[model samples]
Target: MALMTIPLIIFLFPLAYSPGPGNMFFAANGARFGFKSTLKANIGYHIATFIVTYLLGIGFGVGVSYSPTLMLIIRYVGVLYVVYIAWGLIRAGITKRNQSAKHASFIDGVVLLVLNPKAYIIIALMFSQFQPSTIDPQFYFIIGWISAVFTLNNMIAFFFWTVLGDKIVGLFRDKTKAHILNFILGSMLLVVAAWMAYN
Candidate 1:
């Protein structure tokens, strides 16, 4: 178990930092609204991530995925949500670039994390690597503790992605360049949505 720590950190860091739906979502928000405005949503996202990770680590995750009917429903709902978000991002970029509209609300952050399929798979794989053949009395405690650590890392990754997007926009302050940035971000969102639907 002790030897697993290093490998786990290495595995998780890249996975958390990678450009997935969550990272892209934050990046888009920061590009649209700046880091200061996105902080609360970031907090909400991490809170949701922690809760979902904890739930999966403890046991409920298995039951939820075991039912094919329920899993199918979740899959379709998630796909629709991704599409909706992609559409909204594109619309915002094209029509509301000059306005200070809220691109992603706090509740939106929470809901996105909860519904994100990649998040669940990552949490599941993380625990699977650590679980022993037999249940130990201290298992849940360890799981909770490790999940807190993972959540912290997750939050940090989100901050970097958000800041990166914010700074990128700051560099291109001209209207045309800013619009180009928005188009790129919106395009990335569309690609993510398509990827989610395909996978």
Candidate 2:
């Protein structure tokens, strides 16, 4: 059980807490859309893992690394999207209107999972590092257990950020206040984008 916990934690750590495109996307979703909107994103993330994880498992990373160009494209796309999301987040936060929440849709969440380069690389690496043996019932058991962990962890983490976004956005009650928030978030996004692009 202890050994099982360590491997599970390794998988959980990168997915649940890393600062990749998925994290930024979910964080932005939380800020714009209520946690409910974030639900799809959280689900999409694991669905993606379900596809990639069970396929090549640990071997995917080696193949991905060979194609540096693909990584480059994904990295740049992530940077650009992050900037766009930052604008929306700022806008939602500053708007004084008592309008509906500011979350992206399920499709948005799906795309985020698709676009998130960090998630792919990290999960690929983790899969590569760990393996489920044919004879090992423990391996399959761990999968069921890990699935539960990822679900709960994402729900909690996504809610925390989304709630924070909702509250922050609530502060500005009008168009003027919204514009202010927009500017700040947009500017922050610009800086982050530059860092992503450069890095």
RMSD of 2: 3.9
Best by lDDT: 1
Off by over 4 Å in 1: 1-4, 93-100
Question: How many backbone collisions does model 1 have?
Answer: 0
Scored against the true structure, residue 49 in model 1 reaches a CA lDDT of 85
When summed lDDT is taken over every stretch of 10 residues in candidate 1, the lowest stretch is 91-100
What is model 1's C-alpha RMSD? Answer: 2.5
Q: Which regions of candidate 2 deviate over 4 angstroms?
A: 10-15, 56-62, 87-103, 132-152
